[model samples]
Target: MHFPVSGVDVFPLIPPAVAFAVSSVTACAGTSGAFLLLPFMVSVLGFTSPAVSPTNFIYNIVAIPGGLARYIREGRMAWPLTWVIILGTLPGVFAGAWIRICYLSDLKAFKLFVGLVLLYLGIRLLYESAGRYLKTREQTIALEKKFQERMRKIKSKTSTHLAAGIPAEAVVKNRLVSLRKIEYDFWGETFSFNTITIFILALVVGLVGGIYGIGGGTIIAPFCVSILGLPVYTVAGAALAGTFLTSIAGVVFYVVLAFTPLGMHNAFSPDWFLGVLFGFGGFWGTYCGACMQKFLPERLIRGVLGILVTILAASYVIQFLII
Candidate 1:
């Protein structure tokens, strides 16, 4: 199928199928996989335009609700963290969108920026996965192991005895929220972090995500898990929620800009049909990832994801410098 808006042509089924494959993996880390998908759209599909950013946002809008709902239904949503991230991210996304159109429209510069961001994130995650100072990574693995054992027990029961959904013991509970700090309890362990620190981090990540078309969750999730000493199970829901809302804001900004004089000069509006196709795949993928998260080892997930991201980052940088 040919999408005129972005001037891309490919098999109709390819977008969703690829999105499904990518989202299924990234969603386990509280991201919608837009970061990975953007690279695919650019390098593989040859969609390098300002509109691509908003198209990515549309995917987040359509795709995130599935996993977000799953997280909420399982009582894992961290309301305080979600709100803080949204508040910090909204403004940054707007700023980043403007910068994307005004300054980073050139394909080479944008790719380089993306390469650097991914490289930093890849290194950060790989460092965390090294298990040196990340008590939270270790804690998350232990907690998830316990949760999975419980899930096995629940599954082993007869249909009549099986629990309706995630057990209450596995749910996340907000213990406290303040300007300076926030605390949450997960499976009897209380995790605390500085609120201002997260807010600042989200703001920066939002800027970078907006430029790269990812909605900040890709960076936020790992930062929360690796640096802030938060459990992955508790952090995933909040990060996804924040990304969803921010993406909505980003799409609005890009759409509104597309209607202005700027639209004539730059492709700011999204290809809705193409985005929806990717969303369809991402919806089921994210849902599946959320459902399967507790069964996977955190160490394995982080190690694999870090390696993949690092390789992709290296490829982009090399392509930029050599090709």
Candidate 2:
């Protein structure tokens, strides 16, 4: 398939397959996988133009809805948090898009910026993981043992009675929502965060996400979990919702910009055909990943994501230095 806008020629199946693989893992952490996919488009697909950023955003527009629907259906959508994230990130995304088009069009500089952002996120996750391990190792072990026992009982109870494809019951309930704070309950535990703090973080994340075409969830979710001490289960849905909304705005912004003289000079229009191809796979991948997240251990998911981000960040930095 030749996508003239992206100046790439390859099998049509490649993008979707890669997107499916990436989104399956990333969606578990509330990311739409654009952070990883952007790199793939640039390095593997030869999409290095500024237009690539908006193209990546288009993937989020298509890929996020399925996962968002899953989260909402599962009663995991944190509405208050979602609104806060959306409001804060919306303006910043516009600013970031402008910056990307005007200043960061140079691929080298853009890659370096992405490398630094990834490095920061990876290190933050690892540090949080280590801190958690040190502070709560005994408690965590005890909790895991208890959880395993509960799961065993559940399995025994459902072995014959439940249908093979049916998911276990899990729900999120609101405990509180206020101007200063927000709280929710998932399973049995309550998770709380400062609303103001999250809004501030979202603003910064929006800027980075806009420039990177990731829609801020990739950054915000980890920050919520690691820095704000929020549970991943609750954070995942809210992050996805925020990402979805922001991505819609981003795509529209790019489309409008594409007609202007500035847009023509910098290839500001998105490669919609290529993006939709990636989105086709991402849609199913995100749906499956969101559904499976409840079955996986939080620690295991975070550890894997941290490691993957670290490796990708290192590779980007190394490539830049080599070049």
lDDT of 1: 0.85
- RMSD per prediction, one decimal? 3.1, 2.9
lDDT of 2 by residue, 190-269 (tens): 67889898898899989988998888878898888766666677789899989989999888888899898887666888
lDDT of 2 at 31: 86
Task: Please give each candidate's TM-score.
Answer: 0.92, 0.92
**Best by the lDDT measure:** 1
What's the true lDDT of residue 13 in model 2?
97
Give each model's clash number: 0, 0
Looking at model 1, the pairs that clash are none
Q: Candidates' lDDT values, in order? A: 0.85, 0.83
Error of 2 at 44 (Å): 0.4
- lDDT tens per residue, model 1, 127-168: 767766445355655665676677577778754433323355
